[model samples]
Target chain A: MRFGVVRFPGSNCEQDIVIACRYLGIDVDYVWHGDTDITGFDAIVLPGGFSYGDYIRTGAVARFSPVMGEVVRFAERGGPVLGVCNGFQILTEAHMLPGAMLRNRGLKFICETVPLRLERTVCQWVDLPEGTVVRIPINHNEGNFTADAETLARLDANGQVVLSYCEPDGTRAPGGSAPNGSANDIAGICNERGNVFGLMPHPERVVDPEASGTDGQPFLTTIVARLAGV
Target chain B: MARYEIFVTYKQGIFDPPGATAERALANLGYDEIESVKIGKYIRVEVADGPNERARVAEMCDKLLANPVIEEYRIVDAEGAVSAR
Candidate 1:
């Protein structure tokens, strides 16, 4: 299966995504932000890093990149789209996903491995069952997810909340559960149609033990399997 | 050409971390009775004068300058006449 990773002028993690895909034996190509075509790729990944120097706002400028128009069209045609970290921010800005990111609750940049729980949903990217916990690292200064009360309720009922922050033992405390103060401890979400998935953690950075650990392998392999029709 | 100032602030009930930090710092400096402080963005824009100029800028704010989900914006022209959303 071929995966196309979009590289904005300032994207720093596109190479890591290329590495992760290569490790899995998946053919991957770099899709420049200025390019408008995405004809052959089976999946599109918007990797992390400060795009457009995060000017105006994180992902705000990058959302208007020429490639985004093609990406949106691909998504409308049921192609799977994954946005990680700053890529997640761009998804929100482009209105492909719900909610905007506010500054982290602690008002500081955070970089650490946090336990993430998968909630079974319609997302094809995550094949893990509900309530599965994995260790993935999140690094961001503005990752707090904010949405209206009714929208949060709608997302939960529809099973669009794909992943969430949780305690190491797969449990959650009553208060302050999310490290970044995301509403309902939400770490990631998918669109209602279940084709677009966006998350704040860096799965590409943890695809193998050499990169730290292998907890992030399953998330990648499942989608690779889906695209390969395996 | 016309110049305008736009103020963007988080909507009510949304947490403002930077504003809260500043509020706490003020109290530590001996002002205990401070009610609250809000932090927001102040933007200046220059647009060529035309009909419906204020409305056009408001559209820009809705589309890009401000996130309507979390923040509200107000525009003030050179004459200080205010238009808010």
Candidate 2:
């Protein structure tokens, strides 16, 4: 499957996503922020970075980019869209996902590998069994996720909470699992329709075993496998 | 043209890490009497004067200037009149 990785001004992780896709043998190309056509791609990825210099707020300015119009349109038609880190922020800003990211609870930019437990939901981005733990790197200053209590409840009830920070042995850590103090230890979520997914962790950075671990390989390969009906 | 200043801050329930950290730092430096500290953003905009300019600014706040989901913003007129939502 062909993946389109968007590159907004100040976006730094687009190349990393491209490299990961290349390693996965998936056809990929860069979609400039100014361009609007994304019809040729099977799925789209909004990679991590300080888009538009994170002006006003993270992802606020980037959401208005010309390319996002098409991305929104594509997502409406039930097309798969994955947003990583800042991309996740952009998705939330674009209203494709719920909630907003706050600054890390420690008032510091955190960069480290953390364990994530996948929720058992039939989403296009993940097909892992329930409660599978995978180690992924999270790097950001504003990764603390917050939402109203009502919205949080709705997400929980609908199975929209797709991933949560967890212990290495796959146990949930109360109060301390989330390095950034995300609400409910949520590391990732999906739209109610499940076509759109957003997460704070960097799955692409861990796709190569030589440089990093291969725990992230399944994230990309799952899409390819589903598309190819393998 | 009218100049306006906007102050955007996290809502009451949302966590303000920088603000909390600053509060701690101040206490560490022997200012233990401080109750709280909050961090926020200040923005200035110059807009053409019109009958509906105030309404327009409010719209701007809702649409882009501030995220209503987690932040509250106040608009200050040049004369220091504050309007909050």
Candidate 3:
């Protein structure tokens, strides 16, 4: 299957995602944020970055980019989409997913490989046993996930919440280890439809320990397996 | 001319970090009377006079200007831009 990695004007993780897909034996290409056509790919990856300088808000500007038009269309058609870090912000801004992102509670940039607990397995991209922990790198200033009480309740009831922050020692992290202070330690979530997934952690950066860490292989391999009909 | 006012505020459950920071500042000044604070975004737009102008601007605000998931916005005024206020 062909994997398309979107490239916004300030996207910094496009190459990293592409490399991860390549390692999985899937051909990858760069889809410019200005392009509105996504006909040649089976799945799309919105990589992390400070698009539009994170002005006004993290994903506010990038959500209006020319390419997002296609992304929205792709999502409506049930095409698989994965958003990481700032990509998560863009997805929320585009209304492809529920909730919005705000500045980190500590009000500072955080960069580190953090542990996350798998919470939902209904998503096609998720194949891990529930409670499995993965260490993924997350670097951002605006990564807090927020939603109204009703919406949050709906998401929980629908099993849209995919992951939660965990301590390096494999236990729940109260506050500091959670990084952005997201409610309920949420680290990732998917839309009710389950075709789109968005999370603040950078799985691509963790595919190789030498490059960052090797905690991202499971996610990548899971996607590859799905596309390969395994 | 047609006019519209949009009131966007943080969704009820999501913590407003910026708003919290502001609240902390208020408390630091010994202003103990304040109960809580929530920051929000507001936009006022004026358009050509038309029957549907108000609805149109509200739609734009919902689809583009404000995100419904984490914020709620209402069109408070739509009467022709009356006496700049």
Candidate 4:
């Protein structure tokens, strides 16, 4: 499957995602933020970075990029889209996903690998069985996800809470295991339609065993398999 | 052109990490009498005065200057008159 990796002015992870995709034998292309055309791409991936220097708010300015209009239209048509880290922030800002990312509770930037439990397998990006725990690295200053009680309830009821921070044994981590103090220990989620997925962790960073591990391979391979109808 | 000062802050129920850290720092400095501390953003915008200026400012806040989902913004005219909140 061919993936379109979006490149905003400040996007730094586009190259990493491209390398990871190439390693998995998936064709990838870099889509500029100012370009409105995303034709011929099977899926879209918004890589992580401090777009527009995270000015005003994280992903707030980047959401207004010209390419986003096309991306929004693509998502509305049920196109598969995966947003990682700041990409997740952009998705929320674009209203493609619910909730907002707040600053870490300790007022510090955190970068580390944390265990994430696959809470639901309804999304295209996550094909793991329920309750599977995988360690993925998260790097961000504003990764604490929050939403109103009503929205949280709706997300839970719709099975949109796709990933949550948990212990190695798959126990939900209320305070200790959660690195950024995300609400309900949420690390990722999908929209109601399940075509758009957003996660705070960097799955692309772990696709190489020498760098970290291959725990992230499934996230990319799942898309390949889906597009191939395997 | 008229200048508008906008103040953006987290909603009442939302968490403010920097504000909380500042509050703790104040407490550590023996300022126990302080009730609370909330940090927010102050933005200055200049726009031409027109019939729809007030509405335009509100639209800007809603669309770009502030995120209505987790933040509340207040606007003040140059003369310090409360314009919109």
Candidate 5:
């Protein structure tokens, strides 16, 4: 399957997504933030980085970019869209995902590899089973997730929360799981339709065994597997 | 011309980390009377005066200047009167 990676002015992770896609034998193209058409790509990946220099707020400015108008249409059409890190922030700002981001409770920019547990849900990106703990890296200042209590409950009840921070041994603990103090330890979530997924961890950073480990392979390959029914 | 000033602040119950940090710092500096400190953004916009200008500025806040989910915005007209919330 082909993938499209959006390149906003300040995006720094577009190349990483490209390399990851290429390593997996997936044909990909760079979709500029200003470009409005994404007719050929099977899926879209909003990579990480400080888009629009993260001015006003993270993902706030990039949300109105010309290409996002098309991204919204693509997602509304049931196209699978994956937003990683800053891309996730953009998705939230664009209202494709519910809730918003806040500064880390500690008010620090965190850069570390954290343990995340994948929940059994309708998310189309990762095909892994419930409670699978994977090591992924997160680097950001505003990764704390915030949503109203009602929204959180709805997400929980609907299985829209596809991933959450967990201990290394795959257990939940108070205030220990979330590195950023995200509400309910949420690390990733999906919309009601489950076609769009947004997560804070950078799977592309771990795809190369030499660089780290192949623990992230499923996240990128599962789309093909699910669609092709392999 | 109609000039509007917007005050964007996080909604109540949303933790303000920077605000809390500063509050503590100020208290440590002997300002014991200060109860809290909240941080927010202040933006100013100028548009041609018209009947729909008020609605347009509010629309800008709803769409861009503020995220209504986590924050609220207040618009003040050039006369410094609170125009809309």
Candidate 6:
């Protein structure tokens, strides 16, 4: 399968995502933020980075990129779209999801490998059993997800929440688990249709066992299996 | 000319660590009298019309300036200066 990794002006993780895609045996290419056409790819991944220098807000300015229009069209056509970190911020800004990430309450740039519990794994890129715990790296200061009560309820009822930080033993990891103060401890979410996924964790940075942390391999492998029908 | 004020703040469910920390600091500073401290953003705009313009400005807050999910904005229109809600 062909996978396209979007490279915004300040995207720092595109190469990492590209490497992960290639390791999965998928044809990978770079899709510039200025390029509006999202053709020639079965899936697209918006890697993490400080796009637009995070001027107004993290991912706020990047949401207005020329390629975002096509990315929206791509999602509507049922193409897979995954946004990480600032990419998640952009998706929220674009209204592809119903929320926003604000500055971290601690007012510090946090970076570390965080444990994430698999909330719902039936989506296209993931197939693990529900409630599984996986470690993924998260590095961002504005990863707090906030939404209205009704909207949070809707997301909960629809099972749109996909992943959350959890303890290794499977119990809900509180406080420390949430590097940022997101509502409901939400680390990741998928669109109502389940085609578009957004998360604050950097799975690409942990694709291989020796690369950084092997904990993130299953996520990429899940998508690989979906592509290979394995 | 008429004036309008816009207020923005975190939604209910979000954890306001800074606010909590500020409250803690205040308590440590012998200001235990305060209950909570919530950070907020305010914007003021000048327009010609009254209520109609206020509504338009509110819509702008929803569509562009403020994120409705984590933010609630109140607009007040006045003859010269408006106050934020």
* Top candidate when judged by DockQ against the true structure: 4
Error in Å for residue A99 of model 1: 0.5
Pairs of residues clashing in candidate 5: none
What is the lDDT of every predicted structure here?
0.90, 0.93, 0.81, 0.91, 0.92, 0.79
Misplaced by over 4 Å in model 1 are none
TM-score of chain B in each prediction? 0.96, 0.95, 0.83, 0.93, 0.93, 0.78
lDDT of candidate 2 over A1-230, digit per residue (tens)? 79999999999999999999999899999999999888899999999999999988999999999999999999999889999999999999999999999988887899999999998665688989989999999999999999999999989988898889999998887656898999999999999988899999999999989999899988888988887898
lDDT string for model 4 (A1-230, tens) is 68999999899999999999998899999999999899999999999999999999999999999999999999999899999999999999999999999999897899988889998646888789998889998899999999999999988888899999988899975455677888889899999888899999999989988878999999888977987889
Tens-place lDDT digits, model 6, residues A1-230: 78888888899999988888777666899998999887888888888999989864677777779999999999998888889888888899888877888787677888988788888643576777888888888899898787878888888888888898777776775454576777888898988888788999998888777667666666666765676677
Cα lDDT for residue A221, model 1? 80
Q: Residue A220 deviation, candidate 5, in Å?
A: 0.6
Measured over the true interface residues after superposition, the C-alpha RMSD of each candidate is 0.8, 0.7, 1.7, 0.6, 0.7, 2.3
Docking class of 6: acceptable
lDDT of 1 by residue, A147-221 (tens): 999989989999999999999987877895798889999999999988899999998878878658888887678
What are the per-residue Cα lDDT tens digits for candidate 6 across B1-77? Answer: 86676777766756676787888989999996899898776777787765577667877787666766666667765
- Clash pairs, candidate 3, are none
Scoring each candidate complex against the real one, what DockQ results?
0.73, 0.85, 0.53, 0.86, 0.82, 0.41
How many angstroms is residue A204 displaced in model 2 relative to the true structure, after the best TM-score fit?
0.8
The residue pairs that clash in candidate 4, if any, are: none
- Residue lDDT tens for model 5, A196-218: 99999999888899889998888
Considering TM-score, which of the candidate structures 1 and 6 is the better prediction for this target? 1
What is the lDDT for A227 in model 2?
A: 78
